[model samples]
Target: MTAVPQPTAALLDGTALARELTARTAESAAELRRRTGTAPCLATVLVGADPASVTYVRMKQNSCAKAGIESRHVALPAEISTAGLVDAVTALSEDPAVHGILLQHPVGAHIDERAAFEAIAPGKDVDGVTTASFAAMSFGLPGFVSCTPGGIMRLLDAYDVELSGRHAVVVGRSPILGKPAGMLLLARDATVTYCHSRTADLRAHLREADLVVAAVGRPRFIRGEDLKPGVVVVDAGYNEGNVGDVDFDSAAARASLITPVPGGVGPMTIAVLLEQTVEAAWRQLVS
Candidate 1:
């Protein structure tokens, strides 16, 4: 008798989950509109003319439209000073009409990115990049989370992945994705470990993980050989052409569950953005 090949692991299918979330967000936005006669608005700020950043912002705006949210775009020149960028964001933070503010990352070498992020008021920091947002994430409070991390949590919940006591190793330590992702996992009672470029024997750390999140931004950084069989893998890296950090061809063979690049974490990020915008609007109306 011929030996049969093992079945491939199930795909996490973030696109489907994002669609569901968008529908729910639309309903919430509609209700908010009925109550206050104004829809939630998101101000998207893009510095420099990085094509990738431009495309990402456009995608976000389209998602907002689909979810019944309004988006305002602010494009600043590449040479814009840090102080100028901060002033622009601060203006948006004070704009009563804008419920959320999203400043695209890597705002050019000349700008102080953290300062610009901090300029967004906590109430309107729906992108969750502020110091206040980080504190809220660490404490598991009811506040907007970093979009990609928030989306990863939503994806895991959709697949009914049990997080309690599981060893989740997140490879990366960036404030937005990696660090925040680990904290969210911990919030769900998962035993979380954070690793980065400086981590010694990275493969050893991954081998012990029951769950792995690759957000290092390096294409194919996590190999299948490094993974523990039956592990749940989430690929949140978005490189050129929708490439992921994991070696999907190999990692998929070993993982029990895995998210794809383009259709995976990508769509979910925008979904969370729109959802949070609506939430901000509701809170503003109530308060």
Candidate 2:
């Protein structure tokens, strides 16, 4: 009888780590409320009623509740002008009661999303979508980080991944996810290579990477055969039917460590958002 192949990689187990982090955030939130009598509040602004975006916002709000944080939501029409959206976010940013501001992405193709993000006060930019936040991430300043990338860092740390001097390949260039992720890796002294749809001979890059961050957004875009043996894989994509950018089944056979699609990066993203919101509140209320 033929023996079934076993997965060689250790699971990153983001769900378990997120739970621990969220519990600690809850303790921090409780302490803040006890000391300042103010609950950490996050204001979430959704431009359109895109089902996925709405669902993501709801998930973050639910996480806030679990972490003892307050949440305020604003749902705007799909056709709202960029200026109008900016005004909405600016109002939230200026409000003392709102500790953090989250403007959901893909805010209508016509609207200037960057303008709206800039409207958020740098102090209250807990979602970390603003240029100021990106600069902070690149420079390692004392500021909030892009939630998913922050979570990815936390995941790597939890697994004791040695990043310094490693050849890291990031397969995406989205400003929020891919770019900042690479910048953070570079800040840690990793040699980073970026790949996208137009990149030539992508497989050559993957084979040289000690760590691979798959944020390309395409389901199963990175095949197992293309990866180096014992490479660490972080699948940051969340496609339909709980798929990820990397082919998990095949990649697990060769990876040293890998994150699962649903229980991996997804949970950690919200966890980091909640933690940052609470931190923003503490800084605002106490300092």
Candidate 3:
């Protein structure tokens, strides 16, 4: 008897895709600057000294430099009051020199994250954390998207994963990742189901999903056995030890396409951020 060929999943290769997108963004930035003599500028608001957040902000700044976009950083004390932080962010929102605004997450236990996000002007909300941006993404209007979710969409399109009429399960409901991701997929004509910490029968949802997005911030929480064979997986988790929310090996074995943790969603987030920054600057010139 002839042996059947064993199926192996294809890696989505987000890092390579991200590089392509970033190169395009660089070209766009250069053209925009050449025409108007105004380079796109992104203002980063960091409220604390958390190592991870600090590193992320630095990475974004470095990317901006490479793309010929200027980065202005605003650092606030970790113990600052909510009102103070909001005021600080509001100042950046009102600044004419800034095209995009990014406020790093997990600022402090005492500060209200939503309020800080709201302080960012919707026009400059490149990070897409505000209600205005969320509404735009949900309604299929032209506006900035949540960076990580936006990056995931780019990855999906780059790989040509069909979303129309597909059942997509988003495992998590955070404002930045899960909620926006489901909305984006739904806008593409996919049926989206959102799962959170309190979700019951999570495995049942996985079984029905044609596309699965793991962004619950857990380390390898989703196992391979739960994945429906041939499912497309986008794991957006970046936890301790460079782990992802979905177990990569198991899911990759079962999935037809899956994104790697380190090279996947992480790189795409910065790419989206840079792209939007340039767009925001161009918009201001015409407006």
Candidate 4:
């Protein structure tokens, strides 16, 4: 008899799921527009001319158009002071025409990122970067979630992955991504453990995880050897050259379900953003 190779893990196809979600959001947007003459508007704030940031903003704008949402952009010079950035964001928050506000991350080292984020009204913080939003998410209250973390949960649900009472190890602690991810998992009754760069004995944690969320922003930081068999992996990192935080090939070999880099978490993030923008608009325009 010929030898047969063991099957690899199933792909968590975020692209297909995102398309479905976007279509649903577009329908809601159209209905909202039919009821009221105004369409949903999302304001995007970009600082400097960073290539990666520019590309991300463009992608989001394009997605907005497809989903029947209007996009307003504010471009600030690289040398803009923290107070100046805050003033710009505050203006958007006060604008009745803008339903949701998205401030691109890493504005500048010289700028007060937190202050700029705080300037966005709690209701208009569609990107979910404000402390209010974070608190809401942590407490499982009704609020917009951080986009990438929201996407990860949707992906897990789409595949029918069980989270309750399972050990979920998140291998990063970014305010928006990793921290919120762990909290969301915890809300679902999953036992959550967070590990960061300075954490001691990282592999030991991975060995026990039933679910692993890789958001460390390092390419191939988590190896297959570290993961126990049949674990679920969500690679939320997008590094240079389209690589993810996990070594996909190696991790897939061990994982029962895994998300790919470009097609996995990327599309879902935009989908969730568009969804939240339309929802925000509906709230502001309808009731």
Most accurate candidate by lDDT: 4
Q: Against the correct fold, how does model 1 do in TM-score? A: 0.96
- After superposing all C-alphas onto the true structure, candidate 2 shows an RMSD in angstroms of 1.4
What digit string (tens of lDDT, one per residue) describes model 4 on residues 1-287? 95433449899999999999999999999999999999999999999999999999999999999999999999999999999999999999999999999999989999999999999998898988999999999998888999999999999999999998999999999988999999999999999999999999999999999999999999999988899999999999999999999988888889999999889999999999999999999889987
If both were scored by lDDT, which would come out higher, candidate 2 or candidate 3? 2
Clashing pairs in 3: none
Candidate lDDT values, in order? 0.91, 0.93, 0.92, 0.94
lDDT of 1 by residue, 182-215 (tens): 9999889999999998999999999999999998
> Candidate 1, clashing residue pairs?
none
Off by over 4 Å in 2: 1-6
TM-score-wise, the better of 1 and 4 is 4
Full-model lDDT, candidate 1: 0.91
How accurate locally is residue 92 in candidate 2, as Cα lDDT from 0 to 100?
A: 92
- CA lDDT of 110 in candidate 1? 79
Off by over 4 Å in 4: 1-7
